[model samples]
Target: MPGKPIVSSNNAICLVGGAPIADDAISAVFTFVNSFVGVDGGADHLLAAGVTPAAVIGDLDSLSDAARATFAQQLNHIPEQSTTDFEKALTRVSAPVVLGVGFTGGRLDHALSVLNVLARYAERAVLLVDAHEVSFLATLGHVAFTAAPGTRISLMPLGQATVTFSGVRWPFAQTRMAPDGFTSPSNEASGGVVTIETDGPVLVTLPRAHLALAMKAAVRAK
Candidate 1:
């Protein structure tokens, strides 16, 4: 039910949602993104912030009439109820890495749905970023990033994953992790480089200060 896909030449793209996004968060995302794709009412938010998105994608239900008219040329509507705006926008854009802002720190359900999309599209390197934290889905293979010693790192399993970690205070060697099972939260990095190896999907969370490192790992993984 989606309209024509919007392609981007840039390797990195930013997806903006309707949730309350901080000014600094927006700035951080723009720093890496070459193009912006607004999701549903997110177009309005971008317009208010003096940004014109490369394209707007959604169900066309939440976007205001004025915004729709103003951005008609860039609007790509998908009148389907089966998928969320985030999924629609994410699937339509082809980028090596995506920085998602305004999708976190909102209603709990909305934020959870964003994570669901991340797991569903684990092949895509998407980072859900907010003012304080940056998170991404860790798929199969090893991912390495640089973080200061004693930096906080949280490794949470999306479903079922057996993972081994290094450069952390507590290493999980072939540990079986599940949503209802064990998880590593508030773990400190033991050195400048942190590594994680998993056979399945997991979520890696780090402080905002490590966004650059996280982005580097994501781009490398792709």
Candidate 2:
């Protein structure tokens, strides 16, 4: 079961995770989301950057001694082994959108776990940002955005999905996608505007440069 919200906000909230995060990539996130929550050891990252998170939610397995001491009042420990720290924090946060960093770029298994959480919480508008890409759940069933010609757009289905696309180099319609079957990867925008519509859970990924547009599409989908 999902936990009750420990932090709620009208604006987007950024969740910092324990995985490695690029300095520039993490900095860019702060521009879009001023409010922040730390997922366990994520609080250590924020402290290093000299930013204080509103709350720290996780199992505290990876939390650093300094972070625990510094954010003593903000600490929120949920000692559950059923879910990853990312899911623990994500479920406890309420916001218009959730921007996550440091959830990728570490162990491949951990990154995959993050994707699983995104699919499980498909109704929530969440974006996972890495050094080179911005990824999110295509919960709206349809998403439209502009990108320069040849910009890469990848879609991976979390469940069975039928999809259609336009303004892409290899546009397709009624394409069935599933983890066990075909998945769309490295498709590029031909130019101008690109649109994608899906009937089931799908993950969309784009270049980091298109973060703003990705965020807009996620919010609009919600």
**Per-model TM-score versus the true fold:** 0.93, 0.95
**Model 2 per-residue lDDT tens digits across residues 1-222:** 365689999889999998988887668888899688989998988999988999999999899999999999999999989989999998898898999988988899999999899888888899999889999988646778888898999989998899888899999998999999988888998999888889888899999988888898887443
Ten residues in sequence with the least summed lDDT for candidate 2: 213-222
Model 1 segments more than 4 A misplaced: 1-4, 220-222
The alpha-carbon lDDT assigned to residue 106 of candidate 1 equals 72
**lDDT value for model 2:** 0.89
TM-score of 1: 0.93
* Most lDDT-accurate candidate: 2
lDDT, candidate 1, equals 0.84
lDDT of 1 by residue, 3-113 (tens): 445856456888989898887777777777788888998888778777888999889788978778888899997887888899999989887888888898779998888
Where is model 1 poorest over a 10-residue stretch in terms of lDDT?
A: 1-10
**CA lDDT scores, all candidates in order:** 0.84, 0.89
Clashes of each: 0, 0
